[model samples]
Target: MKKILIFFLFFAVLGSGCAQHNAESIYDKDEDRAGTDINRENDGVRRGNGNQDNGMTMTDQNPNLLNTDNQNRHSFSMDVQKAKDVISDAGYEPGSIWINGGEMNVTARLQGLVTRKDREDAQKILQNRLSKALPRYDVKVNIE
Candidate 1:
């Protein structure tokens, strides 16, 4: 009985430690991706014709857009705001837009939430509207 109890306690401690190690590894992986992502965002902002001379780079000004404290909140807010502006200007009424911004990882799942068919249709309208309005951005609308 004594041996069995000791074995169980040891296994429990080992299992817990393994889980903590796994969590730390996941965070480390995200840190790597975040660094790369910030570089790309900064490059895009810099090359936007005259936006680069603002004295600060994109990642320097808005670190949240690159590596977020709360990732879902960060990405969701940015993607939602862009989607709203695009959809609204394309004849969509308020609260009639949904976006499935791409995920950060394989486990992160991509989800496009639309309240109605009208919302989906509005995305199509945005394709035409933004293409004409922001002709320089080369904005391609992919509702998927």
Candidate 2:
């Protein structure tokens, strides 16, 4: 009998708590008292209305963000040509040159059989020359 009474009391309290949450009834009184016009258009943000000069132009943004694919391709090709010239001037046959962002990878082929020290010296010389020529790029030289 005691357990049945406790169970009935718990359910009664829970049911009252759940029934007290009427969202519409709580918000309706505030909405009625505020009395603000719901149909008004401009609410403080500057949206362009055909003739108003807001003074904010798209050209004010960063130039790097506005760079097109054509500009990037031209820049990359120029860098590759520069790398090829540097490799050729260093007395090696330029095989392939690749430029990615600020890094350049260059491959050059030596004509005859060369010793390991000769290859190492050649790589060092090409690396130094490329670094000096293209100071903006981190260069890697491969001799084959």
Candidate 3:
């Protein structure tokens, strides 16, 4: 019984030591994977500054990062086109459409002679239509 107890204790200590070593190695690997190792100078390899010796940046290494900005611009253009379509459908010539964040500034020209009240009414109607079409944006319409 005593011999068995000693054997079990030895194995327990060995297992604990191995577990600790594995945990430390895992932590080190995680730091390296983050690309910002403080010990980069020791290995003579600088990382995580977006530039590498091969003239490639972090964005270049991951093309998805560039795609994110492109996707945003593409979606914004599509939204602008939709606004233009809405303005045309409302019997106004679509002018400039500016989008800043969640706010949209739209300008449309009214054909034929009109009164101030007519312009105001057209602006309101176009604003309502645009707001309904692009609920994600705060719409402001100018009828000229």
Candidate 4:
């Protein structure tokens, strides 16, 4: 009876140790994964900054990093086109306008020395036009 009891206790201790080891290994793997993520983030920041030397004008490595060109494609949906017409009618040239059909938000950044009055007028015109064209979406005009 004593031998059997000793054998059971030994097995129980062995099982618990195995469980502890497995838990430690899992914790180590999680730490490794987090470290990798941090390294990747650092690398991205470095890549964005690019290489710079002493006394030289730094050129943009990725000029289109923000994807502005693709986002500002003149060819827009019908709603955005109508909104542009309204701004033009108000005598405010739409320099950079971004429209997301999915988001249903219109963001227009007017480029140039635009007077505050002109901006207000443009906003009024756009609001009217967008209400008529894209009734479901809201338009936000930002002067750049």
RMSD of 1: 18.2
User: Runs in model 3 with CA error above 4 Å?
Assistant: 1-26, 29-74
Q: Tell me how candidate 2 scores on lDDT.
A: 0.77
Report the lDDT of model 1 for residue 31: 29
The per-prediction tally of clashing pairs is 0, 0, 0, 0
Compare the candidates by lDDT and give the number of the best one: 3
From the highest lDDT down, the ranking of the candidates is 3, 2, 4, 1
Model 1 weakest 10-residue run by lDDT: 101-110
The ten-residue window of minimal lDDT in model 2 covers 56-65
Give one digit per residue, the lDDT tens place, for model 4 in 5-80. 9999999999998897556554344236456533235546523234455443223333323434344433345556
Per-residue CA lDDT of model 2 for 43-107, tens digit only, reads 84434345454553333343234434433333566778888898888889998898767789999
lDDT of residue 22 for candidate 3:
55
Candidate scoring better on lDDT of 1 and 4: 4
Candidate 4, which segments miss by more than 4 Å at Cα? 1-76, 101-118
lDDT of 4 at 18: 87
lDDT of 2 at 108: 90
Stretches of candidate 1 above 4 Å error?
A: 1-74, 96-123, 128-144
TM-scores of the candidates in the order shown: 0.24, 0.51, 0.53, 0.34
* Candidate achieving higher TM-score, 2 or 3: 3
Instruction: Say which prediction, candidate 1 or candidate 2, comes out ahead on lDDT.
Output: 2
Model 3 C-alpha lDDT per residue in residues 43-91, reported as the tens digit of each score: 7786544634586554556534444433234457789999999999988
- lDDT tens digits, residue span 11-88, model 1: 999999889755655334422544553223544653323555566545456644565343243343455456456555
